[model samples]
Target chain A: MKADIIVDTKGLACPMPIVKARKAITAMKTGQVMEVLSTDKGSLNDFRAWVSQTKNELIAHEEQNGEYRFWVRKL
Target chain B: MDEKSQKTTIVLFSGDYDKAMAAFIIANGAAAYEHEVTMFFTFWGLNTLRKEAAVRTKKGFLERIFGAMMPRGAEKLGLSKLNMAGMGPQMIKHVIRKHKALPLPQLIELAREQGVKLVACTMTMDLLGLQQEELLDGLEYGGVAAYLGDASDGKVNLFI
Candidate 1:
């Protein structure tokens, strides 16, 4: 899916990826989709939990070459 | 999100570097998720907020001794376990750098930037002979009443 903003968090560990993603998403407007690229394995669940808590729409997510990509729409 | 309902309160009572790091990580995460987070510093935890440079203050002999013994600032904190005469913290910092993880100081800064509240317990501060001038700026001074007020309204209240 096309993303309004792309955030690369590769090579970071644990909270940094999610932390950076949150900062990125905060700048986005409603209905805009943010794409986050993270290599941290823990971000998979972290993103899910964050999405659930924030009530933001998780458009889709996938993995390639161990990098996790998530598309989230600020609601 | 309802601002009132979206709050997290953490009571930091330990002086261990690892524990403080964990508290900050969670606090930052919660803040990022749109929760108002308050980390109350008490007892040994207050050491995390101390300034690195010595700030001379008038105090009794015992208080002066207490001031001299406590670690100043987040960087000086030692690990809770396997400290190995302070060698463990060095190893942990090295790995944190190698893994691209935010160290404790940076994490604390991020928390502050994200609007996480850092409150120092006034009662503890008095007991430990810590003066406001000795701590980092922009910290709130409060006792248990203040902490309880925030914690009661918080969705998650943790004592670290």
Candidate 2:
């Protein structure tokens, strides 16, 4: 079953958000969706790049209220 | 679903010696767990890629004296400062090295064996007067645009 999960990594610094997001994605079974919310500006590019290199699915990504939201579907 | 479909990327942004150690440890650990790891060294982080004065063999007396007067090795690398706190940087390094269960050189070698891609920032290399030959062999030279393009996939991107 594909589950939708939210990983709120707001107020975290660089590397941590990505680390947390990776942890969440790893914990899930295939086809699960992990949404990462981060305040760190670097996460925007970092997460996007990560998705590409790992063959994970970047379903959606956006910015709102000074926060960046990324949706990743586990491969 | 297939095992070949799973992968991870860790981007290191820190140039600090301690932070580099921590970042390498985590990256190597992930590789040990069968994750595909890519390490992108940029900005101050490029210090690790310096082949000129990065890692050097241990020195004896006269060599030590000469090294003291000259650029010794990565152990005395710039921005890789020794902490003035309790144990200081040297001791801290010793402790970390001991606890991490691998020498710095071995860790780097493991990264290579595990197929960890080494990326050197072209801009940083230019600023440091380092040419392609000045870095370890098999280094990928590129700019932020290149790194972004390479990292465009869905994986893990870390900045140490």
Candidate 3:
């Protein structure tokens, strides 16, 4: 069974949100998914780029109620 | 590692002198890893790349005041909170200079030699009335869209 970890990095600035998200997902086993919520517009790009560096998967990204929702699957 | 991955883009938006130098350090590190690197300089980041200024540190009050009056790039500023170990500023300057690190212009040239792309923000250039000649040569002018597009396919997108 895959786990789903949710990270709320709503108010953090550049590097912090993605840094935290990367730290969180690394503990998970392969195929587990992590969800991240952020308010910084730059975080979207930052997170996506970060995911590319690691062997993780960015499964989905959606914006709702002024918050960004990102889902990443551990690789 | 696959041979097909494209390089990353780093956008630095700082007016501080030290931080800009750190940004260049980071870019050089990334380039050493065989990653394609692109750096976009905007706002205070532009001052470091200016052609005519050679800002040096001064010790005395008069020289300090004169140094203040002179144009120092981002590398000359105080260290960040993450680097404040009391000797952080001194250590940073020592390491940077000891590395025979090129000045911003020479560093940009070295980056070009290593295949790193240098870009300046067109919007900020217009706002500051900076001409192409005022900037180091071989610079591309663009906006946020340009950076985004370059970073869209990148594995590393850093904002320093």
Candidate 4:
């Protein structure tokens, strides 16, 4: 629900959204939370898969209209 | 994840602009995820790493021709399909710019910034008469064995 960083990846294509999120997460301290807003439909799965692979926790995600918001916590 | 699971190896074997773009996008993405990324440039793929300006290098008659015929760098590479005798790459570049996406050269720069290893295939360089000075600097030189060493331990190995 709360985030230390907010990354806007709206209208970006595949990889860019995830790329931005990765950069944001890297700069955060352990246990810090990030909110990512992405309009790229593919990022829904990409972010989930990437978070799992990197061992980060995807606290929750929701979709409104065509936009998606994800709350990720760095473990 | 373990180190191996966070490792990705790619063999770039195409000379097309679009293919090279895709490869670098994936490589950058993997590196963004904090994965160890290695891209081995082989065959025509070596063109992607060539220096745009012509360098002063003495070579045999055939070597000079090979050097002249191939695209000098990432900017000059043609597309694999819909080349349209060169118009295709231009259109692709236009849209890429419109989309605010990183161009091939910028992607390569990002990859370098992200510490993704860029290796030039020595055998291919020799065969194509491409001197070390003809390619972008700060690259590792190796053959297939070197690629295999990285790929064997890599969780994701790709031959593009």
Q: What DockQ does each candidate score versus the true complex, computed on alpha carbons?
A: 0.82, 0.04, 0.02, 0.65
lDDT of 3: 0.66
Ranking by lDDT: 1, 4, 3, 2
Q: Candidate 4 - CAPRI tier?
A: medium
* Runs with alpha carbons beyond 4 Å of true place in candidate 4: B1-5
Model 2 chain B scores worst on lDDT over the 10 consecutive residues at: B66-75
For candidate 2, chain B by itself scores a TM value of 0.71
What is the per-residue lDDT of model 1 for residues B29-93, given as tens digits with 9 covering 90 to 100?
A: 88888898999999999999999999989999999999999999999999999999999999999
The model with the greater TM-score, 3 or 4, is 4
Shift of residue B97 alpha carbon in model 1, Å: 0.6
Q: Model 1: per-residue lDDT, tens digit, A1-75?
A: 899999999998877887888889888899999999999988889999999888898889999999999999999
lDDT of 2 at A59: 86
Q: What is the lDDT of residue A2 in candidate 3?
A: 30
Q: Of the candidates shown, which would achieve the greatest DockQ relative to the real structure?
A: 1
Candidate 4 lDDT over residue span B11-94, tens digit each: 999999999999999899898778899999999999999999999999999999999999999999999999999999999999
- Candidate 3 regions exceeding 4 Å error are A1-75, B1-3, B53-95, B98-106
What's the true lDDT of residue B89 in model 2?
A: 55
Q: What would the TM-scores of all predictions be?
A: 0.97, 0.52, 0.50, 0.95
Model 3: pairs clashing at backbone N, Cα or C within 3 Å: B17-B74, B17-B75, B18-B74
Candidate 3 lDDT by residue in tens digits, A1-75: 133888888765443466457557757889888888888777677767777766578888988877998888988
